[model samples]
Target: MESNGTGGEANAPENLLGTSPGASSLRSRTESECSDKLARFVLPSMDGSPPKVLTLNEVGDVLKNIQNMELVHEIAINPEFKFEPYEPPENSLERRIKDIMHKAFWDVLRGQLNENPPCYDHAIQLLAEIKDCFPQIISQNNTRALQHINEILDIDVIKQQAEEGVLDFRAYANFVIHLMAKSCAPARDELVRQLTEIEDVVDTFKNILETMALMKLDMVNYLLDFARNDIMANSVEYEKKKFKEYLEYYKFGFPATENWLKNSCIHDANNKPCSPEQTISNAYMELMDWDESKEFPEVLSIDKERILKLGQRAKRLCTCAAVISICSGVPVISQRTENRVALAKQIDIILQGTTNEKELLDSIENVWLQVKTVINEYLQKEDQPVIDANTEDMLKSQIMQTGNKDSPVRTLMWKRFQTYFRLAMRSRAGLPPPPPGYADFKDELEAYCTALKRVIAYNHSVFGEYFMKVLTQQRVTSTDTTTSAAAAAASATESVEPVSSSAAAVTEEKSVNSQ
Candidate 1:
């Protein structure tokens, strides 16, 4: 048997063979149908070009678009979709949170100011105020520099430039600074030289002031001693009158004689002396000539009052010095007396108005510490005796009046002294000595610290603790009820609830039912 031209097998004759050809052709047709079905679903490009295989990114984009379309369809169909207005909390918690934030911001600003003080705004304001004062400090030749400063300070021009965002004042500020520095160069150099020349100017000044105070005391004492001696010697009226006159003149000046005669003598209603007895009395009194009687004469009256006044003044000054010494951590009493004498001389020079700024600057170097130490030591040694004597007189008077041995007055005085002494000692203890040959206007530092303490009575540690407590208190109070409720719920769930098998089974059943 022979095959046909189209490769189709011919049917077998009645007497011929066994296999069918259609089975092979059926398998090939099934494969072709599957390929055609797949080709029918292939997508074409937007430009009507042949279909191209999509990349992974393009497929992801198509999936995202389909998800967006489904979301839009769901929103359109849903009837419960409603936009709600957002409501702000109406409670103290919001206010408290704001306050805490405000406090924190101010604290940070304060710290910044402390770290780098004299900020640009303050510096500019200061410059404006002291513009006129600069002329006196600087030389006439610096007029051009002054003009430049004035030009730079023009508010209108500055504002215009600032609006245009081209304002740059740094160069102008630097120029002014350099000019002023140059102008003050001579004064600054002079001060520096004096500081270098003087070994310890502050110590010298303190010593001088202390010695002058002591000398004043000694002079008064000598006057008293002379008066006592004259009275004991039974000096002649002429000599006594002369001594009395000197005391009166010293205490009250020349007007004392006229005033005393007019007041003490017998006078007419017109206040004029009329009798010879009045004249004699006036003459003798004016001369301060008087015999000491059992009552003790009034010849030394003015001197006594003057002494008391001087003593009180000295005591007050000593007290102030002692306080400053304790605060400054410097010993007032130096080992050497020569330093005290030098200090006294320097003070005299200053009082005479002959001392220039350079000399004054030199004396001011570490002055607070030096003055404190010197005054403290002087009070301890010299002024203490006077204070004790005064205190004794007061005690005597109180005793005579109340007849009480244990008075509250005495206790109060004792307590004050104890406190003062304790503070003084504490200030001195463990303080390092100032560096050798180092000098500056330490009084400025003392003044600054005093001002700071006046404003803020509490120390840094106390202030910090208080500030933190305030912030924490606010934070605690500001915590919302919702947060508290949530915390409470969590605690309750943890304490009493356990994940038992029965509970788990119940939860699963509910989920299955919901599904």
Candidate 2:
């Protein structure tokens, strides 16, 4: 074949730019640029090629790495044979298949969790993705899977995970639901039931999942959702550039998979299959179904903005609540008390370098160490006379008056205080507020406030009677300045013009005579 100048063939300089038309130099430069691009674009596929062909022994080693997922096994055993032969199943067969798949999936997850609770995070994630893609398969696969799914539902494992005060299952489940809606449809009943269960759990983890998901989703959608419905829209505005580029890619028909995993910060390029890192990333990516690219957009600019907002809000609320808790006569320690102040200072020391994202997420426990010191300080005052008196009175008058020892208000008060105190310390740096109506986050605020109040109350009950005595004495010495002002006003009125009332007096006398 005759060689074209496309490959690295030496061109005759006389026939190239040297002897061509006026724009020949430009054309030559363009060709050179094109060649450079081709060199970068079409290298040997060392990095991108498929796995090398395995020898018989190597294949056995590979098979050993395969996870024996029960759900996968159950699906493989489907008698409907539609997946293999592409036959349409009858309604009964479809239903049976889905039922079996769902049960098997949950059973596998439960087995995984029981085998190792640490793996529950990975197991929940896989189950959710499987449910999302093959909802139909899950629906009609097998009845056995439903029983296991019900067992998870029965033990309220997901809820327990949340109640245990973590986000492992809840986050996994949420991401799954998100993937399902954006990628495929989940079974209507199953989705609804799981969502309802989620609603009953802690909102903090829910907020975390949703907030993190929105961050992964991008800020433009978040802003657009907010603009369209200001009342219900709740997302931070970090990563707008990244999000905007992502939107552009979407418009250009790019898939959403790789970007989602990339934004989540969980993707691992080195592992595959059963490794949670790979499984989680692949599951979400499969839902999104997009190819990876190096020239993708950067929608990550809003991270600091949202984190700042959340951090500042948390801090201000804690300050206000700390003050109010101290003033409410609820028997709490003063936040500024020497020991408490010292602890706050320690928090300030940590806060000097920490990020709002860290504080809002409460991933840093050192913040809580200072808070615990304050709590311990308050607890030590329980034996003091004033505290003893108040406790005794509270037990006798209020506690005895109620049929139940724990009233909702009191229970919530204590719980709310604990939450608030924890939050105050955990997020001393602050977090951005969620979208509106999300104001119910005040429940969390209330909880945080209550903890501070408890600390204050404990201290005040010990030392508050003396403080109240000092205040009463000060009040006794203070003059009734308002009453004095009123008397002076009356005297001034008497000294002013007397003739103004003459017409009024005549009218009054005439009225009396007529009566």
- Model 2 misplaced regions, further than 4 Å: 1-330, 334-352, 356-515
Candidates' C-alpha lDDT = 0.36, 0.37
Instruction: Kindly list the per-residue Cα lDDT of model 2 for residues 1-515, writing each as its tens digit.
Output: 01232222123221111221231211123335445322221111223453233232332222222211211222222222122222336677877787687667656655655553344554445445344333332333556754544554433466466446553555555644553344322333353334534563233234333333333344333333344433112111211222333222122211232233334333247631133343333332222112223322112111223223433444433332332232223344443355444444454455444333334234224443444444445656655333455543443343222212143333433344334344443464553342221232355555434433333333233323333443343334333554687899998879764765887898999999999
Alpha-carbon error at 168 in model 2, in Å? 76
Clashes of each: 7, 54
lDDT of 1: 0.36
Error of 2 at 509 (Å): 99
lDDT of 2 at 446: 50
